[model samples]
Target: MPSYKLTYFDGRALGEPIRMILTYMGLEFEDNRIDMESWTALQKEIKWGRIPVLEIDGKEMYQSRAIMRYLAKQAKLAGDNDWEAYEIDCAAGTVGDLIDLYRSMWKLSDEKTKEEWEKKLLDEFIPSFMKNWDEQAKNTGFLANGKLSWADLYLHGWVETLEVLMGKEIVNEYPNLKLGREKVHATPGIKEWLAKRPKTVY
Candidate 1:
């Protein structure tokens, strides 16, 4: 078995899905959480000066989504076939779009403007995405292939982040999405990991 070592910040923002994928695969890995001081010291050696880098058998791999997809294939969670993989990618891409949109709010300098952007994100943008995803969940509980896939884990991680950003549980308002998130949380390996994983503010 390849030795796995994940290097990331102490939080879950962009690293949780990759961690979830590895944990769900029953893979033992070094959860190498680092602080800002450590990151600053290590930045010179890191590719692109960013993290959530996975060292597979000592070969480094960067990019969180790329790592998740690679591990998903090994976990048998990518999809059963090509078209299904395409669907999973579509969902993952949409989730990435939402994450980027949320993160962009932090770039605004003006407090009032940032507040306005956040309000719109919480009100219009999130609901729009939720409505569509809720429908998708209603049809296919797993979000893509009517079975568990990495896309579902990806969505679950995003939803967890959204809850932290919103300061409350919003998934309950979207029943199907709530159910779908529950399904992902209930998967055996994932359930165990959630129970044991270190708690973070996200």
Candidate 2:
């Protein structure tokens, strides 16, 4: 087995999709959670000033999206051809938009800002995302080829993270989105993987 290491902060953030790929594959890897100070200190030590760098067999890989696609390849979950891969990437990009939106609100540190953020997050962004993704899920079902792909798994992980962050069950509003989440999560590999999945407290 190839040795792997994923570095990130406490919350799910950029590294979660890679983690989910590793988990679904039941691959053993190191999870490095660094603090703000540690990230600042370690930035100079890595190839790039990024915390979400993935190291495999002593070679460092930067860029979260690239690392995720690589891990998906290793997990044999990326699509069959280049076009299919592009579709998978497109699906992942949709989730990326939602994640960025959540991150912006998550940065608020005050009661009023947080309250305003919570309202805006649920009222403005979340529902819009649900509508878009729900339609995509209904039409595409999976990211590419109507088969489970890296994008499917990442979508599941990103949605799960959103639910945790949102502090409520939100996907019920969209049946296709809910079904998509369940399909990826219920895959034999993913189901078995989730059973022994290591818990991360953040």
lDDT of 1 by residue, 5-78 (tens): 99988887788888888888888899999998998899998879888899999999997788888889888888
RMSD value for candidate 1: 1.3
Can you write out model 2's per-residue Cα lDDT over 1-202, one digit (the tens) per residue?
Answer: 7998888886665667677788777777898878788888898888868768888987899977787888788777777888888888887887778778888876888989989988998998989877877777785466556778887777776676678778878887888877777787787766776676556543
> Of the candidates shown, which would achieve the greatest lDDT relative to the real structure?
1
Model 1: per-residue Cα lDDT at residue 143: 78
Cα lDDT for residue 60, candidate 1: 95
Q: What is the TM-score of each candidate against the true structure?
A: 0.95, 0.82
Off by over 4 Å in 2: 35-37, 106-114, 139-143
